[model samples]
Target: MKFGIIGTGTVGTAIAVRLVEAGYQCLGVETRSARSYARFRQYLNRDRMPLESWVPEADLIFITTQDGMIGSAAKNLADRKLYKDGQIWIHCSGSQKAQILKEDPALPVKTLSMHPIQTFADVGEALKLLPGSHFGLEGEAVEEGIQIVWDLGGIPHRLDPEGKPLYHAGSVMASNYIVALADMAVQLFNLAGIPKEAALESLIPLMQGTLRNLEKVGLPQALTGPIARGDSEVVRSHLECIPLELQQAYRALGRSTLELAQAKMKLNGKEYPRQDLQILNYLLDGGKEKNNHGNCRENIRSKRNYC
Candidate 1:
């Protein structure tokens, strides 16, 4: 199949090169920046062509533009009548639905959103990470998208269009939040008198172990530490030592962890002692409304089988 790309950014260049290596014909790339096109040509070894020269001829076209520009790019191509009938148009925006490309009903093209569920720092990183990565597929051309992803050695998952935002949010939470979490851990280590330089280094193995656990055992089972152990005292000490602003995040995560802990306990045919569970809830809930025992019990009891 002949394929062309509209944006020659990191993702666009990577996809183009990989597709070519996988035996797809390159109709060439179209981009606004000279530097980006230069980089694309450096790896792709293909000519930079005008949109009119390639878009109508390619059987598949990827609009791998920045998330914000995808809609406008698709609209422009549709408006200029560059897309031919039955051609497949795709975007790699995690948060956008395929309908963004089908704004004109009479366009006669198949629209698809195929987002890689992996992070790429550059074209090289993207090329290395694209294979064996999962791609979220949504739109009228889902079957075609799956075939293309498989051809690129990627796993494809069909997703509900309405859930695209939530799906992207989960991806961001897993990718971006890991960095934020590491920073937070390093800060806490600094507060604990660990040298700033040594904080992240020390934390890396611990984080890696946790990731290994997740990979090996999966959720609830993989969860560990004070919250997972129902150690209300340890949690309370953490809140007391952690700065107030940081405590808000700690407490929020504690509550979520508490839910997982409860699930783990149930899975093991165990349960938290009533008082321990209540105290854990109270601490994680910020000890707010001290007199609202009924509210606390209702909330906890409603969500936990052990309660």
Candidate 2:
């Protein structure tokens, strides 16, 4: 299929590069800046062209602009009668529904949302990381979008348009929050008088190891550390050592981790000492623990009615 990308940012360049490699025709790129044209010259077909001129040349038109611009751009395209009956209009927004492009249900163009759930640090990183990445797809040409993902050597996951917000939230927690957590880890290392260069070197391997464990064992089985073992003293020691804000954050995360710990214990036919469990939960919730921790271990293991 002939595909023209409207934006020439990381995603746009990456998609165009992969599509061209996958034997898809590149109609042309439509961009405002000469720098972007200069930047992604290898991927863009022909040259930078007017949006109107570019729209008609492709079977698929990808509006890879910023989130705020997507709706306006799609509306402008529809208003100008630039889209044809059978042309597919797609965007790579993780949070937006396909309707952002097909605002006018009367328009004959098939609309879609095809978002790659991967971080793009740079064009080079995007080019390398996109393959085997998972994409969230929705709307009229979902199958076609899935084919494009497969052509890129990526995995495709279907999504309901109404659930895009929650789906995006999960992606944000997984990707963006992990970055924030990494920053926090660096901050802790900094407090210990460690240089960022040294700290990052030490920390990245630990993070990568956790990821490897995640892929290898999956879920509760992948979870480790003091929380998994229900070691109340260790958690309390960690809380005392960290700053107040980190302590709060630790408590919040530990609350969630406790559930996973319970699951792990059940799966392994193991039980945590009730006193140790109670102390940890009390620490997590500021002296409040959930639903009779004194009996939680036996309740979880014997009856399987986990607290």
Candidate 3:
């Protein structure tokens, strides 16, 4: 099948290069910027053709522009009446639904969203990461999109249009939030007098090991450290020592982690003693009280169910 790409960014260039390598003919690319077009041509050795000439001729058209411009790009061709009856129109945005291509229910062409769930820093990275990546697919041409993903050596996951936001949220937490958590760890290490560079070097291996544990043992089982062991004293120490700015975030994460600890204990046919569980929950919940030793005390004075 012949394919034309309407954007000349990293994704578009990488897709064109891979598709040509997969024996798909190129109907040429379309882009407004001369610099982008030059880069696209450099990668694929294909001429930049006008929209009027390529849209009707190509079997597949990829609108690989940034998220905000996808609708405009599709509208441009739709207004020009350039789309053919059986052609496939696709976008690579993770969060946008394919229906943005055309709102008309009777539109003859098949519109689809085929988002590769991987990060790309450049064209080379995109080409390297695109294969074996999971793609979230939706819209009218899902079966055809699945075949296209197979051609690109990608895994395909069918998604409901209504679920696109949540799907993309999970991807963001997995990819982007990891970076944020690493930064937070580094900041705490710096506060402890560790150099930023040294802290990062030490933290990287620990993070990698945690990821390996997750892959090997799977969730709930992979959870570790003080909370997993129901060590309320350690958690109380953390709350007292950490900066006030970070306490809320730590407590929020701890609350969620405590639930995982409960699950892990249940899976092992063991559970935290009721007093221990209540103390851990109270510490994570930011309850403040003084015991006889002038230290933070658990909410044992109240008859409330911390569970």
TM-score of each: 0.92, 0.90, 0.92
The full ranking of all candidates by TM-score, starting with the best, is: 1, 3, 2
Q: What digit string (tens of lDDT, one per residue) describes model 3 on residues 1-307?
A: 9999998999889988988889999987888889888877778887876788778988999999889999998988887998898889999999899999886667679999999999999888999988999999999999999999999989999999999999999999999988888888988777666888999998999999999999999999999999999988777767755667778889999999999999999999999989879998888888844433232213212322121
Candidate 1 matches the true fold with a TM-score of: 0.92
| Range of the 10 consecutive residues with the lowest summed lDDT in candidate 2 | 288-297
Q: What does the lDDT read for residue 211 in candidate 1?
A: 91
Any residue pairs clashing in model 3, and if so which? none
lDDT of candidate 3? 0.87
lDDT of 1 by residue, 205-285 (tens): 999999999999998899999888888777766665565667888888888999999999999999999998999999888
Total clashing pairs in model 1: 0
Cα lDDT tens digits for candidate 2, 112-197: 99999999988899999999899999999998888889999899999998899999999999999998888889877766668778
The candidate, 2 or 3, that scores higher on lDDT is 3
**In candidate 2, which residue ranges exceed 4 Å CA deviation?**
42-45, 288-307
